[model samples]
Target: MRRHARERPEAVALRFLADGEDVVTEWSYRQLIQRVSSISRRLAEAGARGERVILLYDSGPEYIAAFMGVLQAGGIAVPTYPPMGQRPLSRLIGIIQDAAPRFVLSTARTRDTQARRVAELSGHGALEWVASDELPTRESYEDVPVVQDQPLAMLQYTSGSTGSPKGVMVTHANLLSNCETIARWLGPSEGRRGGMWLPLFHDMGLLGGVMQPLYSGFPLLFMDPMYFIQRPVRWLRAISKHRLTLSGAPNFAYELCATQIPDDELQGLDLSCWSEAFCGAEPVRSETMQRFAARFAPYGFRAEALSPCYGLAEATLLVAGKPAGTRLRTFVSPRQEDGGEASPEAPRELVSSGRVVHAHRVRIIDPDTLAECPPGKVGEVWVHGPSVAMGYWGREEESRQTFQATLPDGPAGYLRTGDLGLLHEGELFISGRRKNVIIIAGRNHHAEDVEQTAEAAHAQVRKGGVAAFPVTAGNEERLVLLVELKPDGRRTEAEVAAVREGIIQAVVAAHGVRPHDIFFGSVGAISRTTSGKLQRQTTRQAYLGGVLPALKVAP
Candidate 1:
């Protein structure tokens, strides 16, 4: 960092954009390192090395500087997305309780504005509040800075799309190694320029958006996530106007731009210069990739630019990435893995997530037998590499269960990704989560397959707003469906009943399994994690507890 500061003092290392075209803040390489050093000194004064510091911020350049400062000061940074509106964020609260941080770091504006809420949070006797901007900036170097085997660097909280979030412990070696791996795998951007609109609190956004630029010595443009959400076209505009060589988002973001943007809005756009548009963080739907590429083809987007990747917080962000310009590999699973009998219509389309990146070695193993699965067969995905995190903080048993697994004949321990996928021609194709597979009678169906089918059954149902899970009834697990109806205040009960029937019939026709019960709910009834993936099991809990509000299909 100091080397960059000296070599390229005035080069723009970071830029934060708010609204759309406005540049709210920016930091040069020298300025960024200076701020980091100053904050490091302040942190050293207040907290001991290896102590946990809770970071609460909506957005700002200070967030990035302070995040780096925590590591420089030998403190573990725990960045959290501060609640935006009225009702308290239960997820943030849960994380806070679990982290049990001694110091809470926030921007001065956040500290002043969220007075009452901040009071409620910091009222805990042992917790201390640390304002980022107010921290003293005396450049004091540590006697022993970053030993070969130092303590853990940060605790990244999982997105909790499936269950309660756990803190993935990331050591210094793990952090630096993953950043290097990302650079080597993806290659450096043109002029070392990149842009991202993903929320900084998420692992992808943090690593790829913020840390990657610093680690690789590049300029990064970041816009507020809300602005991008309000207008997905803004993302493409930023990439084009900036001539970014690298940028990415979750699969749903690409789908939004493909489906929601009108031709008029897309006019005069040029994305020819944007290369290596990495997409990951959730299931990379094949249709989404195709639609996005076709939609932007006239505007200079290339299919090879559609880099489909796979990763998780436990792996410190990236695991696999496709080579530039190589199209995704497609395969059809056998009828047994396809959830029904053998027939021409039984083949399900699955897309490859490219190949494993750097030193990461991925394998498919039978979940119960612990034996490696043959090629073209779907099974649990295991990863072994330097990028794998130390373990889940404070959850030793879970850490062991997830991060430590023996293949008997193969490697001693591998990270049980909990994801089901197949390896073909050295490329990885992720199917779905093992816990998320809805087994009905004898057939196994991925939740995504079921949910997409239900959403497609009716016009009134919102796209990407269906949750399918298995609920135990007596001794057997029965399929339960939750459909989010598009907001129509005056819609009659009969219409909802028709929609429910449509969903059930579609599932039966597609997968040959009828849901045990179908509940019609209003828009936004389905809960998503902080990173915006649907929480199926969480929704199931709400349904079983009799608290999930559902529209009456029949009056």
Candidate 2:
């Protein structure tokens, strides 16, 4: 950042959009550095150096400036979402309790309200509050000296899609290594512009959206995640308006734009300038990408722009991704893995998440046998690279188990990603989460595959809102599905019967397993993590507890 300030002081470092069209605020390199320095001085004066500081801010330049400020003041930054009304506040309180930060940074507009809400739930009233947006800036400012010895730069909390959120210890070295690898993967950035609506608190949002652009020496424009969710077309509109070369989101975002946006709203949409439509943070479905590309192809969108990638917070945002404008690699495998009737004609198709980044090693290993799986075999994905984080914070036993695992005869220090995938021709193809795999009748089945088929079976079923899991009933495990229906009036018994029959028939036909039961509810019935990943485990627990808001249940 200092280098950029010295070299390109007048260049725009960041821009924020209120409506995703009109620019609300923008910061030059010089201005950003000055704001960062000012915040750093205030933090340092308040004895924040060498302490953990929690940052809670809406999307804007204040969040970026405060993040750099925390690093400049030699403090470890812990970024988490700002709590909103009626939303799950437990995640935020859980992160705060786990990180144990000394100070909380936010704009004056949100500081008091958030602090009050957090204190009521967290009981951490001693945490100091710093209004970063209200800090006074000087005309000419010098960078504050940061401690060079502290290896931990930030604590990136996991999204907790399956369990409790754990803080992944990210070092300055991890940030630099991943950022450089991303820059290389994206190729030259000359004349490139970046845009995003992902939450700044998430790893994909902070590292991929913010750090990558900064490392590549390009300007970025962004808006609140809620703003984009309210109207996803705004994301594409911003890209077209600014002629952005790089922008992307998870598969759900693409699905939303493809299905929700009207033709009139896309009258003048042009996406030719969108070169890198990177997708990650959740499963990337080929169907979603294909629909999005075909829907907007007439408006200059290219199929080659759909880049599917894979990574987790433990690996510091990016593990493997394809270069822009490359042909997507896909693989075909048997739909049923456990010796069911094999159909050569209807094999399941999977998309590759490109190759492992330069200088990184990826291996698929059978979790139970502790042996490496041969190429094209599904197993747990293990990653070893500089981009891998130190470990989970304050959980030495788990950290050692997850971050220090060694192969029987292979290398040590490989991160056990807990994700299942395979390598075909040097490209990684994710299958599903190791814990989320449902086994029934001695056959292995991925929950996502079942959910996808079930969701597609009925038009009334909400896409990306189905959860498939196993429940132990009597002496055997039975497959069960919790589905979310589209928002409509109350359904009659016949309509409910039709929805249930569609799901059972589709899932059985596709995967050769009949759902023991199907539960239907309204939209938002399925729980999601902070990054919008479906929480199957949470949903299952809710089902078992009889707390799920089911409009109808089919036996």
Candidate 3:
């Protein structure tokens, strides 16, 4: 950013589209630097240097300026989304408790309301608050100190898909390494304007959406994530309107675009300018990508532009991604027979998340044996690279276990990703999560596969809202599906029975296993993390505790 400001002071560095189309606010390279420097000076005066400062704001330019300002002031930035009405305040309270920040940076519009809410909920009202937008801009002539090894830059909290969100200690070195890897993978595409609608609080948004553009010396256009949810075509239209060469989201976003968006609204949509549509933050489904590409192909969308990648907050952001204009790779795993043997009759397609980025090294290790798995075998995905974070904040034991893992004879420094995948022909194919895999009849099945199958079986079963888990029956483990239904008129018992039968038959035909039970739930019944990743464990607990709101149950 500093280099960009020095070389191209007048070039537009950032643009915020409040309506997801028209630009409401923008910042040039020089203006951005000046704002960041001024905010840094104010924060330093507030005794924020070497302390943890929380950043709370909606997605916009002010949040970006405050983020850079915290880094300039030598403060660890903790970025989190503002709590909305009826949305659980527990997440914010939990983060506040875990982070224990010295100060909070928010907009004047939300500081007082949020401060009162936090004090009422968590009883932590003594923390200082600064409205970043209210800070006066001042010229800064002070030279930044040159440090070979910089300290912690930020704490990226996990989305808590499996457990409580932990703060990933990201250092300046980690940030730079990930940014460089992303830039190198994207290469030098001409007219490389970028756009994003993902939340700035998430790693995908922070690294890919915010830092990557500045690092690559390209202008970025962004909007609130809600705009995309309210109307996904706005994202495509933004890319078309701005001629953005890079942008992407999780797998479900593509699915939503294909299903929710009407054909009439996409009459003149031109996606030819979208060069790299990277997908990550969740399992990338081959069916979803294919459907999306086919649906938008007439609008100048290319199938090869879909770059399926994989990474986590612990690795800063991206760990692997296909180069632009490369062909998508997928692997077919044979279905397991009744006796737990591979059967070639039924094959499950898995999309490859490209190859490791830059100089990073990846290894597939058996979780129990602590030994490397052979090629083509699914195991825990472990990564060792410069982009990997130092460790989790205030969690020495967990950090050592998760980030300092090692094989039997291999050197240390591997991060145990707790994700199941295999390396096939230099591409990584993710299978499922380590703890979310369901075992029934001595065969291991990915929960997502079952959930996807169930979702496709019935039209009423909501897409991306099903959770398949294993429950202990009398003498064996059985498959239980918690399904969320789409909004529709009241259904009779006959209708419910038909839906349950359809899901059961589909699961049996696809995976050769019948669902032990099926619970039909209303919309929003399934629990999801902040970033929309399904919390299967949490859903399972709700079911076991008899608290899951089920309109109908089939056994």
Cα error, residue 136 of model 3, in Å, equals 0.8
**TM-score of every candidate relative to the true structure:** 0.78, 0.79, 0.79
**Ordering by TM-score:** 2, 3, 1
Candidate 1: tens digits of C-alpha lDDT, residues 1-555: 666777878888988786666665778887787777777777778864678887788766888888888888888899886766422244465677777777777877776766466447535456677787886554433332542344698999865322244789988888888999888987755575789888787888998778888888888988878888789999998888888878988777888888889899887789998877888776676777888898899999998888888888889888888876787677776641321112232355677888898988999888877888899887888999998998998999988898988776777558988888889898898765666666443234668777878889999888787999876553234689988888777788888778888988887766657899988776667878899889876677678777888764435
Candidate 3, residues 359-462, lDDT tens digits: the string is 79999887877778787877788999999999998999999999999776777989988887888898998876566556453234667667877899989888
The TM-score of predicted model 1 comes to 0.78
Clashes of 2: 0
Better of 1 and 3 by lDDT: 3
Measured on C-alpha atoms, candidate 3 has an lDDT of 0.81
The models' CA-based lDDT, in order, is 0.77, 0.81, 0.81
Worst ten in a row by lDDT for model 1: 336-345
With a 3 Å backbone cut-off (N, CA, C), the pairs that clash in candidate 2 are none
Give the root-mean-square deviation of each candidate in angstroms: 9.7, 9.9, 9.8
Candidate 3 lands at a TM-score of 0.79
Model 1 Cα RMSD, 1 decimal: 9.7
lDDT of 2 by residue, 123-234 (tens): 8888899988777885666646755777788999865321256789999999999999898888888998999998898888999999888788899999998788788889
